[model samples]
Target chain A: MIRQANAVDFWRGLALVMIFVNHIPGNYYGRFTHASYSISDSADLFVFLAGWALRHLVGTPERQPPTWYLVLRLGGRAVTLYAAQIMITMIALAMLASVAILRDNPLLLEWHNAAAVFHDPIPTHVGLAAITHQLGYFDILPLYVVLMVMAPGIAIVDRFAPNLLLPLSLLIYGITLAVPISIPTWPVDGQWFFNPLAWQLVFVLGFVMARPTGIGGVVRQHIVPIRIVALPILIGFVFVMRYGWWPDPTWFPQPRLFFLFDKTFVTPPRVIQFLALVAVISVAYPTIQRYGPRLVDFLSMLGRNSLYVFCVGSVLSLAGQILRYLYRGDIVIDTVVVIFGIAMMAVTAWLPEWRERVKGRPAPKLAPSS
Target chain B: MPAPFSRDCQVGSTATASESPLPNVAAALRDKRKLKILAIGASPSAGRRSARGGHTGETKDILQQAIRGLDVEMINRGVSGELAAQAAIRIRNEVALHEPELVLWQVGTNDALIYVPLGELEQTIVETLRWLKERKVDVVLVGLQYVDRMAQDDHYRLVRELIRKIAAQENVIAVRRYEAQRLLAQAADSGGGLVPDEFQRSETGYVCLSQYLARAITLGVFGGNLRPRELQNLPPRPQN
Candidate 1:
């Protein structure tokens, strides 16, 4: 039976909300709320849950579908998502260009130029750079696609020959560390905004743990102990960082050993921090599952259709910007407009559920227990 | 060891100092009150060399010896190849550590070489100087010398004017090294048969130039107690 964990859905929904809240300018509540968690930490947990949900949806062992069928299904979703990304980029570029021309400002004109835009505002540059080559933060979509395509090959090894996944993942992770892999930053900049080669290890680890095997069973059983150890370790790491234990390399030459744990490029310390966060979440999962009500259900609904929600949310954000441009006065008014935009997105996200409920089809059980 | 000089050796007459092996040059140069002077900047003040040989002059030692007997301790805290922005980043740690009474800032050269936009460079320098001034650290901003072969064009002039404007607006002492170099070249021309061509053209040109400028800056900061002969006779530049 294809089942989803309500707990996972609730958390994923919460993360999506946090992501949206963080994206809005002047909205610091989300950051403060998740101050204990790094974005990568939340992202790692979300990707892991994604793998777990995939396993549940497709079934494991006895009820497993054929490898080819699984590949086709995952690959199709990836392609569809990638195509959607391209369409969004084209639209965004057109909007930016139109805005620049309408403003008739030299600075805005310079911003439209790829080289100048890349130098001045990197985020927008990365989005535009995606058109020619994958050079934006959205490179994550392509990376996810690659992983999905390789998941079948991984699934085969995972099912019959589970022991191979660890050594192979470790090898890939080691290579990722040893090799200096960087994606180009665009028109003028050469450095990668985010290096996927290093980041892929997190996804691979998620994939390896997703299988209903010995490691997963161990994780399920030892949740409390993992949390007990992880919480202190994470706290200590944060304390060390805050106190400036790592010497500024400009003042003194830093040793190569320190680079092993440097998180500027998703180093091992980041990986440890991510795992620690997951351990805490796993311990809290059961509680969230029990107490989560309508409010949690709303978020889980948003999480279930995250890609669709993100696309709609992005367009709503554009609308919010347009409104602000027209009525630029009170901070209270701006905040209200942002809230209205979020509400609009929320309504759009729940439309399908409302339709299904009207048809008396039990709302298709959006939250599943794995 | 015996006191370097006897209390009686404080005689005004030079005749009293002929017998001492190490005459009281320090006593002669010492003012009653010590002035807390802090010398800082990029590599030029740090007394380090860059890859381009543009910063070959060891101005630090010249400034050090020029103020040696004066009631001032000149601290050199220059890092090699640092732009103004990098200097701004480290100012809190570096300049604040010294608690300097007076800061000699010689930067902006590397920023030009590294192709940092002039606007950013100006902002960084202005903010850094403002930060120091707010902290009550008196600043003496040294303009870049036109030594880089690549910077020999009109671009160097533009950079020099930018530094001048920053110095003026901040109400800091502007040490015009480019003007000083031009004056030195003019002095060499005017000295005709007295100053040898070798002193102006040979590798010693930078040594003499730095020593001369250091003496001028020292005299400007303190009074005329520093002697030109004393600065010229200091140890030779260390060769690798």
Candidate 2:
């Protein structure tokens, strides 16, 4: 089934690699990240893929059992991600603490927002577990959990009132952006970096588009027209990014929030650029797949096992940061770290299949017997 | 131009160059002897981690101990990787919500690390400080930390210089975190530890940072108001 949708998986895999590279913050490799050239980064790609994956996982209402069964399954996934967030957060804190203690750098404890764990462990730990607090890079999962919890509802709406969902999702997104509301952080006061309210539109778009429904059908049917609009938008963003030029936020009669290229609430420019990116890239995938079979297969493999690889990649990224701190990693060292980390992720991606073979679950084919 | 002072400056004894910006603090000091200070910036000022950096902790806890016997209500809103621009947007709301007399802003490090254009960084400082000044909020700009890797970093130097320059131009207190930390390291090296180690710059580093800030606040707020005491002679007590 995933093989049929290898492009999604391949893109997700590409997103994973990008996420890993971008997570290092100040690393030399980060300069090459897509965010430098575009408003949307791998975060948009990853979230969109998540929505696509949800559609794939639950094909249609008829294909799934009961609504309760769907809710239970989706709820179970949310719980798993929640547990993973806590586990990874603890490991990251320990990693920071270990580095701080071993290297005699108290600064490490304060860096990456780990100061709460050392300074005020009780409330910070409680906040982290409650999903009210999150470390710098380990934030997306809590958001993923919320989206998963919403999936059953989305599925129900998709099955029954398909036309209602997108507009409703957009309505909520638009109003939130206008009102400028976001979830607040607890134990420490602030707000979530990626506001789920605005981001859900992209996720919902990904979901709605997978099916040849109203808006999705129209867009898919008018590919040429969309591509014609998408190409120039894509090219224009290249200039915007490279030149650091943005539409003036001070436009009269329009709220500054509407135009600013803000990440917290996925602004219009970001959403347009991201959609354009998806359209343009999706249009070319077929050509690339035929020409570069090996590349597609490699990325698709990583994509197929995204959850495992993402968790490992996130952990590995934190480790990479610590190692960079210890070594003061130069460009050469940063490159080596990235290559080695991606290789480890590749091995991790393959390990499940390797184990399945070792257990004789899916024995290798006997060539001579045929 | 006044050089940024280390922790040893007889801070509280001398009036700050300007009047206090925090009317609430001034009012409380005059009426109830309870000064509620809301320090918001990165982790050192006391908030959670922002997107890029994970600087976290109650830098306020350290300050509470540093400024004991002076009913100081220290509220921290430090978010690591929080730029001055972002803080400026959030600050007005914070001022409305918490209503502190003074704001201690630790800035420039995240901007430097991300290679945000110097002009943008300067604009952020200028705009944020100008807004604070208009609102009569007494602000002390805490400069960036000293990292061995940053010595050769031109961008880092520029950010540090900008913070200092802004403070000088605006007649605001600028706590020289880099110089103070470097001084601590030098002192430690002279005392036999060649490297000065991590705690000197981390735990002790934050402790010193908070002390420097707390002392700056005391000097800024209680200069002529409080009975004179050589702040350098009074070491900040750790309120564990």
Candidate 3:
């Protein structure tokens, strides 16, 4: 039977909410999200959870699917993500253009790195399809698509040479950081907000850490001491983030991406702090499940339908931002936007299961689960 | 075709053109027969052609015409309503990615509008400017637009002044957008014509802006150093 409320679903759901809140810049709720306290925000957690779920999708050795089947399924998922990204981008542009026309404000067309679509349509359209033109705040899915495409290779590496998997991932991550390279956006001449080469490390770390052997085995065995070490690092980062105590990027050596707390490259500081945050936060899942059963079930529902919820939430967040812009943002308006957006996301999540019931089949697996 | 604005309107736009050399740009033009520039900032930095067929591309054309066989390629990375601090991060990333020889940074208005702390804006600009300089990239600081109402706003004045000070201190060319626009408006008012909005949200303004930048870049690069034959193709130096 499908699990009702597990730790993975609960955390993924929480990350989705944080992402929704954070995407709407200047929303009052944004100040309270993980970004305010943690070096790595929902993007990191979301990507990591995606990597964790990959393990479940590929299945355990006893029930492992054929290599060809694994490749096809993962490849299909990547195609789906690419399609979703294109759809959302089109919707976002339509929303922006509609508002610009209704309000007679030509300036609105330029919001979120969108000016190219309006001014330079032909090339920008090609760039958008090629994943070279990503609207701001709507960039994560392209990164997800790229990661998904890399999934087959990752799976093959693990299947053939599991021992070399993480080392290879880390090598790519190191070279990406040391060389300080990024996937450039075309027609606009900027770098990807999420550097895929650098981010694969987090995804690989998630995949490996989700397993019951190797690093994962060692980590499980040393959970208590690990948490003990992690607690202080997490607390220290809270202070570091609160006080803006990061070192100057100029002071850093030639390759500044290595030391700096850059979100795009997923720098070392962010990696270390994020790992620490994970170790510390993992302790709360059991407590949350025991004491907050209703919350867990509600969140688990949303997490189960993550892709749908995420896509819907992205559109809703954009709507919320537009609303906030039209009516100057205030605490009351922000509260309404957040509540309405989240409530709509929950509704979106619930719809899939409702359809499943109507068809008289088992509850459909909306997303990969651990 | 040349821009619609009269030659007189272009005179006395910016302050005395700084004779600072754009060595990288010069070298690129010399060896590769091409100049790659990255323009990054708020709305004004976008030199895209408007629906009304504005002279946005004229900036490239003017540069190309100035030196025979020289190709001027521009990459626009402008996001409207972006603050200086945000643009600084993008500038670094873009510089690393494109490795352009010249960077045209239109700044100040959005930062002033949002009331971003002056210190933060200054630090971000100073650090980024230094970083660009270290990479041997030529920089042109396009100052804030001249808005009649904003002229009285203390923060606006402070922002313009701070950018001017940074440009002077850094020894990079500062396109005196505010001053140039003010001059054009004055000349237009005196001549009994509707002032072409040099910095506002209009195609006419964008056209005039292109000419001003092209003029400034031409002067900053050649600065009486161009061969006499090349000098014949250059515009008359605008008097202060």
Q: Which model scores highest in lDDT? A: 3
Clashing pairs in 2: A104-B198, A112-B54, A113-B54, A113-B55, B21-B138, B22-B101, B42-B78, B46-B78, B47-B78
TM-score quality measure for candidate 3: 0.77
For A273-348, candidate 1 gives per-residue lDDT tens digits of: 7788777756665665578566666767777766667666655554444343334323664567657756766787
DockQ value of candidate 2: 0.19
Candidate-wise lDDT, in order: 0.50, 0.70, 0.77
Worst ten in a row by lDDT for model 2 chain A:
A247-256
Residues B20-51 of candidate 2: C-alpha lDDT, one tens digit per residue: 33444445657767665656666653322322
lDDT of 3 by residue, B147-209 (tens): 555667687799989998988898888877777666555555455334444223333345567
Runs with alpha carbons beyond 4 Å of true place in candidate 1: A1-5, A35-41, A106-139, A185-192, A240-264, A315-334, A355-370, B1-240
- Give the TM-score of chain A, superposed on the true chain A, for all candidates in the order listed: 0.77, 0.93, 0.96
TM-score of chain B of each: 0.59, 0.72, 0.82
Instruction: Sort the candidates on lDDT, descending order.
Output: 3, 2, 1
**Model 3: residues with Cα > 4 Å off, grouped in runs:** A361-370, B1-40, B43-81, B88-104, B108-211, B214-240
Q: Write the per-residue lDDT of candidate 1 for residues B59-117, one digit (tens) a residue.
A: 44444444544445555444433457545644544443445556656676545543456
- Please report how far candidate 2 places residue A123 from its true position, in Å: 0.7
Alpha-carbon TM-score of each model against the true structure? 0.54, 0.76, 0.77
